[model samples]
Target: MDTLTSTSANTWPIISNIIGWTYFLSWSCSFYPQTILNFKRKSVQGLSIDFLYYNVFGFLCYSIFNLAFFFSEDVQDEYRRRHQDSDNLVRANDVLFAVHAFLISFLTLSQTFIFKSDQKLSVTAKTFLLTFIVFILTAIGAVFTEYIKWIDVLYFLSYIKLLISFIKYIPQLWMNYRRKSTIGWSIHNILLDLSGGILSVAQLVLDAAISGDWSGITGDPVKFGLGFVAIVFDLLFMSQHYIFYRERYDFYLAVDDSERQALLPTEQS
Candidate 1:
């Protein structure tokens, strides 16, 4: 019985590590599909500039969160003390993924400037930027005055990352609805993103099971919520792609057929 139990315990961490790496890969590559699609199309017509705006800033926050968490000895010690399972703790991959995400987002933003597209910054984008600026200034002031501890600042950054993750899709969702098409967007990216989200959540679950610690399941609530919400939004985008946007393309094909037929008759006459 001891041998069996030991074997089971040993296997779970290996499985968890596999899932974690898979999640990392999925997320790391998720942006490429959209970036490639944009380059191929040479237009951001159906894409939302506001979406890019929020994404860039969101990733910036995420990068900061990862950096602060990785560097702060206090945070690291607390995490170790709380979890008591060092194997399942945050690794270099987490920081690497954050860095990769930020770079990809910046590249996507560059696309907006390089490519000619009808998409423009919406009122919502402006509002978000302004609000984010104010929040950053306030946080800086608080930090300078020592009104909030560095650990608390780390928590605040984590919250910002969570907020950004939760709402980042709104601009694109709204834009797709307004345009009634997903022409300029890449469904492939959403598919990859959904895959990453599921894998990330699975990693968390596996860690919980392996360590036999569930108290902290929600301890990093924002990280957990980010994965879950990303999955939700990815599905939403997929539905939009198949149900709504597909019909639009079909209608466009029909119109083209009719116009071609009309021209043929005129040419025959």
Candidate 2:
């Protein structure tokens, strides 16, 4: 029994690391699908600009959180002591993922400006102004936190990121519902996001189980909750794409065919 328990304990971190890397890879690639879809379609129609707006800000907060955690001596020391590793608990890929997310979201936002779309889902001028103001305020806050050496602001930024993550999908989900179709959104992106979210939660679970440290599970409730919520949203998106949109598309096709038949005799005469 002792040998079995020892082996499981030894194997868990390796499994956790594997899951972490899988999540990193999934997250890294997730944004590309939307970018590519937008480029190929040459339009941001049916895509919510508000989603991109919130996403860029969310990624910005997440990036700050990762950078602050990675650089904090206190955080590094604690992680090293607990894990008996020289490296901090926060992985370099976390920072990289955050950076990539911001960049990709920015790219998607650029598409909203550059591409012409008749879709009403696009952000309004008033919303753009509001977003600009928010950005400026956030920048000022960041500067203030840095100059004052208010390190606890890092936690605030992390919580903001979590809040943004929780709400960011809402606009997109609502837009899809209003449109009754997921026409312009990329299912590939949602699938990748789901994979990443599941892997992230799995890593946390494995780590907690292996270390027999339940506190580790609750230590970062934001991270855990974000993963779970993201997965739920991703699944909702998949259902919208596969089930709801499919039905809507078929209905539209039938209506179009009927209209065409009705016009046939008029055109013939």
lDDT of 1 by residue, 1-269 (tens): 21225668778878878888898999889999989877876756567887788888887877887777777787777566656644324556677888899999999989888886656678876887788779877887898898976656666777877887877788889877876677678888998899989988888776766666664555566667778999999999999999866743322223566775654442222
lDDT of each: 0.75, 0.72
lDDT of 2 by residue, 46-76 (tens): 6887678778877887787777777778766
| Candidate 2, run of 10 with poorest lDDT | 246-255
Model 2 clashing residue pairs (backbone): none
| Candidate 2 lDDT | 0.72
Candidate 2's TM-score: 0.75
Error of 1 at 206 (Å): 1.4
Off by over 4 Å in 2: 1-4, 74-89, 117-151, 247-269
Supply the TM-score for candidate 1: 0.84
Residue 210 C-alpha lDDT in model 2:
64
